[model samples]
Each structure stands twice: as C-alpha cells, then as structure tokens.
Target: MGGASNDSSSSTTRCGVFELSIFVAAIVSGTACSICSKTMMELHGVGIDGTMELFTKPIFQTFGMFVGMMFGLIMHWAVLVLKIPFPGYEHTSALDNDQRPGYNTTSTNYGAIQSEKDQLLASQASTASTSNATPVWMYFFLIIPSIFDLGATALCMMGLRYLDVSIYQLLRGSGIIFVALMKQHVLGDRLFFFQWLGVFWNVVSVILVGATAILNSNDDVDLDPNDAFWGVALVMAGAFVQALQFVFEEKVMSMEDAAAPPLLLIGMEGFWGTLLCLVVVYPLAYYFPGEDHGSYEDPFNTYEMFMNSNTIQWSFVIYFFTIFAYNLFAVLVTFMLNSIWHAILDNFRPITVWLTDLMIFYVITETGDFGEPWTKFSVVQLLGMFVLLYGTAIYNAPNAGSLKLEGQWYSFGFNLRGEYEEIELEIHEEELNREWEERQQNFKARRTSSLAERSPHTSIHTQALRGFASPKI
Candidate 1:
C-alpha cells in the first residue's frame, strides 16, 4: 500500500511539472505573437519623402493569420493520412468494457468474446482507413464560427492600429463580461455571487484602462485622443463579437454527434476565413472610401509594399509561427490541465506583453524606430491590471465566497479546489459502477425471459442454473 501511494504521488508530480512547462510556453508564445504583430504594423519603410511608417493593413494582417491556420489543417490531414500517434486519439472502448464493475473477464467464454470484439474493431478501422472523406455538413457547420472569428479578428486588428499592444491585451478582458451575460441568457448557466462581483470589477478595470489611454494620448506625438477612444470602442466591440463566437462554438461542440478534433476545427475555420477575406473582405475594403486611403488598409498598396520591405516580410513570418505556436500550446494546456488553469495563465499574458513592450522601448530600440515608446507609466494602468487579474481569478475560482488552493506541488502549488481531483475520480468510479449494475440486471432479465419462452415447464431454480451456466455475451 505504501509503495502504491508513493508511486501515485510521483506520477502526479511529473504531470504537474509537465503542465507547468506547457503553461509557461503558452504565455511566452502568446506574448511573442502579440508583440510581433504590433511590430509588423509599426514597421517603417523608405519612400519618396523620407523614412515613413507604411504598414497599417489590418485586413492583410487578418488574412495572414488565416493563412497560418491553413497549416493547422495540413497538420490534421497529415496526422490522419499518416496514421500518426497523437494525443486525444486513444481508443479505450474495449478496455472500458473489459474493466466494467463486477464483470468477470476470467470466465470460460471471455476469451472468445474479447477476440470477437477485437476483430470487429479491426474491421471498423480498416473500413475507416479506406473511406476518410469528411462530411459536407461539417464544412458548412464550421463556417458559422469562422465568420464570427473573421469579424472579431478584423475589428481587433483595426483597433490595434490605434492602441498600444499592452492596452489592446488588457481591454480584451471585456470578453468575460459578454461571455457571462451570454451564458446566463443562452446557456442558462447561473453565476455565483462572487462571479457577478468579479464581472463588476472587470468592468471597472476596462473603464480605468480606457481612461488611461485617453488621458495619456497627449504624451505621444502620433497618437490622437479621438483615435484612442475609437480604438477602445473597437476593441470592446471585438471582444463582444469574440464572446459570441465562443458561445456559438461551445453550443456546436455540445451538440450530439458534432464533436471534431480541435486542430481540425481550427483548420476548417481558417479555410473559410481565408476564402472570405480574398473574395469578400478585401474587395469591399479596396472599393470602400476611407479618410486616409493610403495609410489605412489599402490591400493593393499593401501587396506592393510587402514585396519591397524585407523587414515587413520577416515580421509577418515570425508573426505566423508565433501565432500558430501560441494556439497549439494553448490547446495543449486546456487538454492537459483544465480550462481554469488556461484562464488563469491567459490573464497574465497582458502583463507579459506590457513588460515586453517596456523592454523593447527602453532597452532594444532607444530611437523609437520600432514604434512609439511606452515611456509614460500611469499608476491607474497598473491598478487596472491588478483589478483585471483579481477579477479573473475570482470568476475562475472554484466554490463561492472564498478561494481554496490545493493540488500537487508541481501544479504551481495551488488549484482552485482542495479535493478536486479526488472528487472527480470518485464520481467517475460511481458512475461506472452504476452503469455496470444496470447492464447486469438487464442481461439477467433477458436471459430469464428467453429461458421461459424456450421451456415453459422449466422450474425457476433450473432457469437460474441455466442462466448462470450459459451467460450471454
């Protein structure tokens, strides 16, 4: 018993360490993606006049992200076609059936039953390998979320043009508010009192962050107060749209027979997004009139400038890889750990981006070549960051009123619930046991009924003996 306990403890510690590593990787990659994207937009090029900041093509930026998503689809296809061993692909149906509670695998007929099950599974696998065509309805079903993603990303990119990367990250917390409201109305989920309080604090954080942007607009020569306000509005609107996407995606995933691999879903969305941008969004932007046609997202000019500028080219390349890496790591974190851990780590991403922005401004680029310096530090902005973090923690914390930290030492020394893992294990075991009991009762009833039909004059004791002797598979 003691040896078994020690082994379990060691295994849990290893899992915790692994999850923590993935969490850190997710944060770093996500921050890199954000910073690289901003750098691409702020990069300057030599023109007829002088050195001018030329890249402000939000639509093109969105298109590049969709192109990166195509790689995810390619990966999914490679995995399926190559028969790769990937996480979340484990087939446990036979194992689960064998391990059912009170089921005797040592029976005389157990070997035959197991062999037949294995043969059936192998036949199904062979059939699936020969015909792997995806259903057409899946493509149509995924387009809904893709449209939402396209709109959200385009709006955020447009907003990013006006605001600093740090502010943009912070303002994204507003999506929690929209998600909460939607969950209540659409999903009929009830929020605890603490969660509602967290929402209120999040609202305060958004207000504070927006006020800081407007107040410090005069410090930067290029930033206009009106533009900053519009940027805040645009980001908030993007957050709302993104929340809608999240809710809709959840609904789709929750439906019966609608489950798909995460990477496959992402790839499908990328396909639709790329198609829409090329045929719809780009054309509309090109024909539509704007106040600053050249400076704004003019795709024709963007293509010309992209061909000439190596800096812009390298920036986009880095952005593409970092964004893909971030998404991959984020998905891994969600699968390996839990959504709560993912949310907690995500709240820290804005802080990482902010510190990286400061380092770039003060240490890397002293001449302000990359972008405008974030030299002016506001106390209110710091307060807003803390408020946002606290609110997120409150919302994600398990239970109500108070927070309890419990987990393995390697799980960052804290989890939302004290007995979360143990409780989940116990509940799962109970469910399995109950299911097994029901199946046993049903099987006995069927055997008894068949015996009665076959031999009407058989005694109840003889029927019982016969049922036990010749157990049905």
Candidate 2:
C-alpha cells in the first residue's frame, strides 16, 4: 500500500510539472505571437523614411493566420503519419455508445421531459446510424466556425491598428459576456448565481478598461480618443463573433456523430478560412473602398509591400510560426487540463503581453519605433486590470472553497420548475423512510427473539404483564 501510494504521488507530481512546463510554453508563444503581430503592423522598414506602414493590411494578416493554421494541420498529419507519441493524439470515437441520462419523469414537467426525450432519441438515432469512420460530409460543418474565425480575426486586426496591445488584450475579456449569454440560450446551459455575478463583474471590467483607454489617451503616442472608441467597438464586436464561434464549435463537437479530432477541426477551419480569404475576403478588400481607399486593407498593395520588404516577409514568417505554436500549445493545454485551466491561461496571457509591450517600449526601443510605448500610468487602468483578473478568476473557480464564498448562495439556480432538485429530494426522502422502517422491523424482531428464548412460565408472565398494561385492548 505504501509503495502504491508513493507511486501515485510521484506520478501526480510529474504530471503537474509537465503541465506547468506546457503552460509556460503556451504563455511565451502566445505573448510572442501578439507582440510579433503588433510589431509587424507598427514597425518601420530599415531604409524607408516615409510614414508608410507597409504591413497595415489587416486582411493579409488574417490570411497569414489561416496559412499558419494550415501549417498546423500539416504538422498534425505529420505527427500521425510518423506515429509520434504526442499527447491528445488519439481521436475521439466517431460514435458514442452510452445513451444520455434520462430525466426524472415523476418530478419533471411534461414539456421539459418531452424535449429531453426527443433530444435523446435524436442522439441515439444518429449514433446508431454512424459508422466507425467519420463522415466526409460532416467535415463541411467546420466551415461555419472558420467563417466566424475570419470575421473575428479580421475585425481584431483592424482594431489593433487603433489601440495599444494592452488595451486590445484587456478588451477581450468582454467575450465572456457574449459566451455566457450564448451558452444559456443556444446550448441550454444554465448559469449559477456565482457565474452570473462573474458575468456582471466582467461587464464592469470591460467598461472600466474601455473608459480608461479613452480617457487616458496618450498624446505623446498620437492616441486619438475617437480612434480608441472605434478600436474598442471593433474589438468588442470581434470578441462577440469569436464567442459565437466558440459556442458553435462546442455544439458541433458535442454531437455524437459529427465530432472531429481537435487538430483536424482546426486544420479544416484553416483550409476553409484560407480559401475564403483568397476568393471572397481578398476580392472584397480590393474592389470595395475602405475608410481611406486601401488605407485599411488593399490586397494588391499588400502583395506589392510583401514583395518589396524583407522585414515584412520575415515578420509574417515569425507570425506564422508563433501562431501555430500558440494554437498547438493551447490545444494541448485544453486536452491535458480542463477548460478552467485554459481560461486561467488566457487570463494570464494579457498580463504577459502587457509586460512584454512595456519592456519593448521602455527598455528595448526607447523611441517607440519597434512597438507602441506604454501610456502614462493610470490608477484606473491598474484597478481595472485587477478587477478583470478577479472577475475571470471568479468565473473559472472550480468551487466555492476556491474563493471562500457561500456555496449555497453561489449555486442558487433560477430554474422555476426545480424538477431535478425535486427528484433528488424525493429519492432522499424515500431512502430515509426505508431505513426507518428497517430499523423498526429489526427492533421488533429482536424483542420477539428475546421472548422466544425465555422460559414458558416467564413468557406467560410477561404476556400477562403486557396484557395488564394494554388495559384489555
């Protein structure tokens, strides 16, 4: 037993260490990706003296990201083809054998019961029809997520042009609000009181962050309030779109027959995204006039700039590699740990990006040439950051013990029917009644056995005493 316990503890420790190392890699890669992307847009060429920002093409940046995703797909295939022993390498079964849990018919409402039954039947039917091999037609469902990804990435890149990296990162917290709302309506996931509270705090954090960005605009950095407002709007809109993508991906992946491996799904999305950018997004960017006639996105000009600039070309390469690494690490983190851990990692990413931005601006390039400089410190921004982190922590907290909050209050649900809880209560009451009856029966049996063991005279006398005590009843 001692040896077994020791082995278990040792295994857990090693696992923890490995996960920690992966998390660190994820942070580094993610931070590097963000900084590289921002630098590509902001950094000037070595000899070019004009104010021409060569990499101001948000559409091209989006295209590069999809290309990176394609590379990720290739890498995934390579691992499979080589039979490499990678974590999360095994694909999920295309069909699930286990049926969905049934609702408590005694306590549940007719409507909810019927709905659950219908869903269960549908799932069973699908699973029964599905073969071991994933259907080719199901792969096309990935296009939906890919389209959402395109919108989200393009909008964010466009917004990144107007905002600081820190602000851009901070504003992303708003996505949780959209996700929460979508989960409730689209996925039928009900939020507990604490989660709802967390959502509220997240909203407050976003508002604070946005206000700080607008009010504390740095004149030295040529920060405009109007531009900042537009940036916040764009980033928030992108976050909303990204939230939709997340919810849709979850919904699709949860399906019994349609589920695909994470890497394959990402790869498919990338493939579709790249094709869409080339055929649709790029063409639209070329023909349609933007804010300043290609100032925002001109595919032809982007091509020219890419051809002429070595720095731009190298930045794109770095961006591609970093994006791939970040996605790979992210998927690993999610597979090894839980969604809560992934969320925590995401919360940490902004801090890493913010600190790296400060280092680059203040220590590495004191002239604001390589990256945007940190604006004058604001107590509000600092407070908002803390609040944002706190809100995120609250949302992802595994239990009330983790936050030292009242568990009952935190877990309070607003479901009017309370069907599930009622079922549980009924079961508990039945168990208690059964145990009480068993105890009474045992007591009577013990008394009867004691009487039987007594002598006949003693038994008669005891019966006579019981009869006298019963008063002729």
Candidate 3:
C-alpha cells in the first residue's frame, strides 16, 4: 500500500513539473505586449498631437513607421557585424547552475511557484484552471496599460516644458514603487524582503531628489494650458499603466500559447493605433480646433509631403537622433526580454535599457543640444541610481531561485553560436529528460510489482537533484 501511494505521489509531482514548464513558455512571450505600449506612445506623441491639420496632411505615419523599421533592420544587421556587446551575456555567471545545484538544467522559469499545492495543480491543468476563473476584464487588460503608458509619455514630455530633467526623473522613478504594490496585490506573488527593501530605497531616492530640486530652484517652470496639467496627468498615467502592465502580464497575459509573433504584433499595433487616433482626434480638431488647424510647419507641408519638403528644421534632426537611439534601445530590449527563459528575474531589464538610453540622451544634451543634463548631482539624485540598481537586482534574484526549484525548464546558460542552435539544443534536452524520467518510473514499478519494497533509488534522487541542480558545475 505504501509503495502504491509513493507511485501516485511521484506521478502527481511529474504532472506538476510539466505544467510549470508550460507556464514558463508563456511568460517568455509576454514581452510581445510591449509592442502595444510602443504603438500607443507614437500615436499620442505625433499622430494625435497635431490632430486636424494631419487629415489634409496625408496618412504619413504608416510610411514613417515602415521607414523607421528599415532603419532598425539596418542597425540590427550592422550590430551583428559589429558584434556589439549584449549586456546580459557578459554579466550572467555561466556556472551559477553548476555552483548552486546538481541539475543539468538550472536556467528555465524564473517565477516558478514554490508551494506544493500550486505545483500539483499546475501540472494538472492549463493556465485557466477551474479553481480560479480568469477575470473577464483580462481580455482588455492589455489595452488598459497601453492607454496609461501613452498618457505617461505625453505627460512627461509636457512636464519637461515646465520642469527640469531632474524633477522629471524624480517623478518618473517614483513609478516603480507603485509597481511593488501591483506585484503583491494584483499578481499575488510574494516578493522577498530584500526586494521590498530595494523598491523602498528606490522610491526614497526619487523623493529626496525632488525635494532638492524644489529647494534649489529659484523659479517654478509653468507651461501654457494645453501643456501644463495634461502633461503631468499623462506621465502619472504612464507610470500606473507601466505598473499595471507588469502585473497583468504575470497573472494573465503570460500563457504558454502565444497569439502572434513580436514583429507581426508590432506592425498591426502601429497600423491600428495610428488609424484609430486619426479617426478620433481629427473630428475633435475639426470642430473644437486646437493645434490641429494650423501646425507649426507651413501650410503646404501636408503630413504626406513633410518628409520630402525641406521643412524639417535642423533642430528636428537633433530630435530624430534622440528618437533613433531611444526607440532602437526600447525595441531591442523588448525583443531580448521576450526571447529569454527567465525574464522575471531581470524583471525591470526594460528600465535598465531605458536608463542606458537616458545616459546617451544626456550626452546629446551636454553637447549644447536641445536636451540638457542637470549639472549638480543632488544627494537624492545619486540615491535614485543606487535604488534603481538594487531594485533590478532584487527582481532578478527570484528568477534564478525559481529556475533552481524547477529543473524541467533549464536552459544552457552559455551563449550559443546562433539562435537556431540555441533553440535546437533546448528542445533536445527536454525530449531526453522526458525519456529518462519515463524509464525511471518503469524501473520503480517493476521493482514494486515484484513485491520487494525498495529504498529510494539513487537514479531518482539524482533526477530530483537535476531538477534543482546547476547547469554549469
């Protein structure tokens, strides 16, 4: 009876292990959701901004998007030739798996639930388990974050008119703390104590920086009606949107079956968003005219002819480069975060990628460009960087831990010769493990049916260790 019970327990554990593997697969594609954010930002910033004048202006965004993508493709090709350093590969310890556990795979899912109940249940069902019905709102949850993110971008850009970069950074950095609440309450994931500490430290840094900016500035930077409140509102909205996106993706969007490829989603998003904004904003501009009636550019300069006409001031070139660097970074980081096995650990890898863009932006500012970097580093400003760093580390820590707990989802930590090679090896490993486990179960059943109850098999012990073991050592 005892032997029979053990077999049942082992079968249950095997099922759970399979379910977790699926969850990890889904989480990997969650990065595709960022296409929605990117599309929304461009729509509001350029599409909706000049509103009405653009209708006669020609549907240029579609073309501009294609052109922009061409540039991105060229850059990607160039980077391949240049062999640009991808940051994650350099920093991640190849031997972490080998050093910690004894598994052949210690690098798979980052947020594997540690509880036995979750594991067993996960093995038995798909993501939409009968125990917890998926919230109906989940269908539109992705859209909610997109709207807020666009709002944030517009607000921050507008806030820039009134506030200095230092002030804006302070406010912007504060967004992550809101994320901690989302992660805990919405996603129901229990973060480590240090992770909370890291978040607190980051938020405190932003507050301190803002206080310093207020104390030092002799004048308040205020803007016109169109620019003031709406700008601030947008950025705050963006922050909330960002926080919401992370939580929703973790809970609902990150599933094993993906709906579309990254570029396909990005393309559709850009096309739809541009069309929708034009439809909504153009009518409003027609009757309740704002910047729509007459744009800053000349009358003949329709959106269609804007690029060909020499109407683009040299100053806008500076802006284009800034956009070029920032957008490129944003798009690439999104791709990397999506493609990886344990994105949850480096959860805010997007933030780090954004900061790198900011640093590049600072250089543009320092060269007496349209952008300006703040000269004096207040104590608060310095602390914000530290907090950001710690927060990123804390988020990533659990990813490693999760992989340690679930051995079924391990990835070869070493960088492969090519993307195809990497994928093939990963699949091969999974198949072999499945066969290995089946054989072991068969051996155990044979031993039991013969009625000689045996001790725990060494192979079984080793296999369990492999689930938790490090890949490198």
Top candidate when judged by lDDT against the true structure = 1
Q: Could you give the candidate ranking by lDDT, starting with the highest?
A: 1, 2, 3
Predict model 2's lDDT versus the native.
Answer: 0.61
Q: Between candidates 1 and 3, which one is better according to TM-score?
A: 1
What are the Cα lDDT values of the candidates? 0.63, 0.61, 0.36
Candidate 3 residue spans exceeding 4 A from truth: 1-149, 164-170, 212-233, 248-253, 285-369, 373-379, 398-473
Angstrom error at residue 60, model 2: 0.9
lDDT of 2 by residue, 1-473 (tens): 00111111111111245667788998999899889988888754332223355467688888988888877677667755664434534321112222211100011111222344345644654454344344688678789989998999999998888877877877876777887676666555555555566677778878888887787665445577888899999999998997777666544443443445456667888899999999999888777767534434666566666767888889899999898787667655544443234445555677888888888878898676765454465556667788777776555444222232343454344332343333335445645664685466445434432212212222222221111111000
Give a tens-digit lDDT track for model 3, residues 1-473: 01111111111112134334433433233222222222222222223334322222212322233233234435433433453333111111111112211011222222322455434433443222222332334333334433433344434544444444434544555565666665455444344444455566656655554554554453334324444344345445555555554443332222322222122223333343344445653344345433433532223334433444232323233333433343333333333332111222223433333343355447644654223334454445556555555554443333333211112232224222243233345446755886797577546444422322323333333343333211100
Instruction: Put down candidate 1 lDDT per residue, 129-199, tens digits, no spaces.
Output: 33333456877889887898899889999889888888888888788788767666655545444566667
Candidate 2: where are CA atoms >4 Å away?
1-24, 45-54, 91-131, 218-221, 291-296, 332-344, 399-402, 407-473
TM-score for all predictions?
0.73, 0.70, 0.45
Q: Give the candidate number with the greatest TM-score.
A: 1
